[model samples]
Target: MATIQEIKIDLEEKSMRTLLSAGTNKDCKIVAEGDSWFSYPVVKDIVDHLRQMGYAIKRHSKPGDTLENMVYGTDFGIATQVQRANNYGPISLKETLRSVKNLKPKFVLFSAGGNDVVGSELAQYLNHKRSGLPLFRENFFRDSVNGHIKSAITAFLEQVWQVDSGIHVIMHGYDYAIPSGLQYELAGIRFAGPWVLPAFARKAITTRTEQNRIIRQLVDIFNELLISLSNTYPNFHHIDLRGRFPNEAQWHNEIHLRKEGFEQVAKLFHQKMVEILNYNPVA
Candidate 1:
């Protein structure tokens, strides 16, 4: 088995053309796109673990990407703008689809929607405690998840099918996160997150129990949505990661897991991949 550093290809640092010329077997090639779960800067993430399992992964994920931007955003001048602002280049799912067409990878791993649900836009979905309304504006939350996120996912999958109908699309519902108010920091520099806590504070829902309940409900709903969406596509597979990291010790921060936890999650992904490849045996 190749080490993570040997198998993982950061797409930003290397061109797709160069990657193709490196003589990797297309059957073991994987294109991973989405948010920090796939590209966490502070620690080894799921993609790193998958690479150690022998997949040659071309990663196009960034730390704070949203499903909408990833699927619909263009490459033209957007990468420059995003790189200037975020210090990392933009993730273009269109470019990823093109890679899929060229590389003809057997599987595409997508990790998204977490940013869409818990990012800066989270406040929009919350109702103030003073309003005496539901914690979440249920209708708005449902509409955004189903209308925007789901639509973006569907669009990406449609493009993937066009590129290669036999390509398997693998997605994971992130495990339930603890809104512990712990922001991700590295070397005394705060990078990202405490994503859910501040929103809960602003809404005046400050109790730890209440925060846990709300986060669990949100994650559950998101996972259920993904599971339902997976059912509609013959080549799409959804990995249910709920309850996988049941302890606070497994989580590194609000939205990410510790390295060992991520490795465990990667094993689940590997298991699914093995099952698919064993049954189909990608030629």
Candidate 2:
């Protein structure tokens, strides 16, 4: 496996035309964007694997960015908070646009919006009746969450299509996350999340079994939304990762994966990319 440093060298040395070339010196220019999922070693492994197969890559993923920031603007006050947990700085939609215009990639790999729904928005979906509050608010999905996500995705893609309608946008629906409140220790600080797990406990959704169900419901909603968008947009392709990793061992923390875990998921992404692009560098 090549280090991120080595991958950086490849990204810098490759040109857009050469990256798009195929059959002789086979290569494809891929713009990788999104969340900590892509910022981690999982995406690193994916890029390295693609490089070994002769694909040139340029990654613009930010470790703690959400779809809002990536498309709208940076308003997440916690942007500076999790620096130690995942080190890449914020990259806004404007910055992403700048790259798209400059690089003219064949495909844009995006992974985001998980943070938006995972944090405070999750509580709205829960049945808080055990706390003497009302049951699940039926209007919450339509009035708040769904429209917000749909609009963000629509606008994000609209902007990308405007840049170049030829660019195929690749995105994935995250696999279900356990409400385990698992923490990973790095540099003496313990970073554990989905964050909603602890939030669930605070709000009296105490049972692990119940927490898991609620979390799964939330994951399903988001994944369904992605699928719907794929159906709506011609250039957009969605990869459903719902059942890709069934074992709990795949999740390092509540929201992240271990190295081998990332490798497994990366292979899935690679397979889907090859299928959509119809150009297999490995072959």
Candidate 3:
């Protein structure tokens, strides 16, 4: 059995080659889009592993994309806007379908909606709970959030089908983020985070354990929404990644996992893809 470090190094090496040779091979193109989770090394490692097993990966993810819009770029602070200038010109649902008009893809991996609720929106949700508004009014905001996410997902799926009715989509609900407030130190760039932890503090939910529970509940709501969508779409599959990293050490901060943690998550995604598609690509 390969050690975690060995697995990581191999994935990293393959990722560089696969990325460099992107769009060159057309035999086994797979499109993956969504948020930072898919844009970062987590899903990239999975793509690398898949490519090593004979697959060509085409990615459409951005670092801070939500269900409806792609964020401009890497805005390290609390992200408030979902719509922004796509400086990177990411392949969105529209672009994905357009790309596939010429050539069909086997699978689409999507991870989104986490950003829509995490920052100021989260604070608003909590504030609504404290507001003296009628029960129906409070429910309106919560329901609207879920409704928007579900509708966006439906639209994306419909577009995929319009391009190729046979395309399979693989999506995952995010794991519960630890309220660590740890600073990010990847390569040379640095950013401070654990955005939820600070947000909870600002909202007067200062107790760490209580904060964890509240955040977990919030995450559950989103996951349930995803599950419902999965049931509705025959080709859309949802992987529950809520507890993949249960400990603090596995996390880099609030929303992201460390490399080992990311590897585990990616392996789950890879395993699910192989199981569903029965993909046995020639190496």
User: Highest TM-score: which candidate?
Assistant: 1
Candidate 2 residue-wise lDDT, 94-154, digit = tens: 6777777877777788888777766545676666647675434446754455787888888
Better of 2 and 3 by lDDT: 2
Q: What's each prediction's TM-score?
A: 0.85, 0.80, 0.75
Q: Per-residue lDDT tens digits of candidate 1, residues 1-283? A: 6544443444333434534665766667788988999988777799887766666677888888888779877344335656653323335966798778777889999999898887677788888888989887778888877887888889888888998889999999998778788899988888777888898899998888877777777777888788898888878999998888888888888888999998988888888888888742222
Task: Locate the minimum summed-lDDT window of 10 residues in model 2.
Answer: 82-91
**What TM-score would candidate 3 get against the native?**
0.75
| Stretch of 10 with least lDDT, candidate 1 | 6-15
Give the lDDT ranking, best first: 1, 2, 3
* Candidate 3 whole-model C-alpha lDDT, 0 to 1: 0.65
Residue-wise lDDT of candidate 3 within 1-283, one digit each (tens)? 9764466466556644654564644435677777767555332344444545565566666665666564223324333586444344323656666656654667777777777766435666664324454212236445855677677777777778888898888888888877777645555566434567667666666667766776777778778887887888888888898876798877766787765665676677667767776764432
lDDT of 1 at 264: 89
In order of listing, the candidates' clash counts read 0, 0, 0
**TM-score: model 2 vs. ground truth:** 0.80
RMSD of every candidate to native, in Å, equals 5.1, 5.9, 6.4
Instruction: List runs of model 3 lying over 4 Å from the truth.
Output: 1-27, 41-54, 70-91, 128-141, 187-189
* Candidate 2 pairs with clashing backbones: none
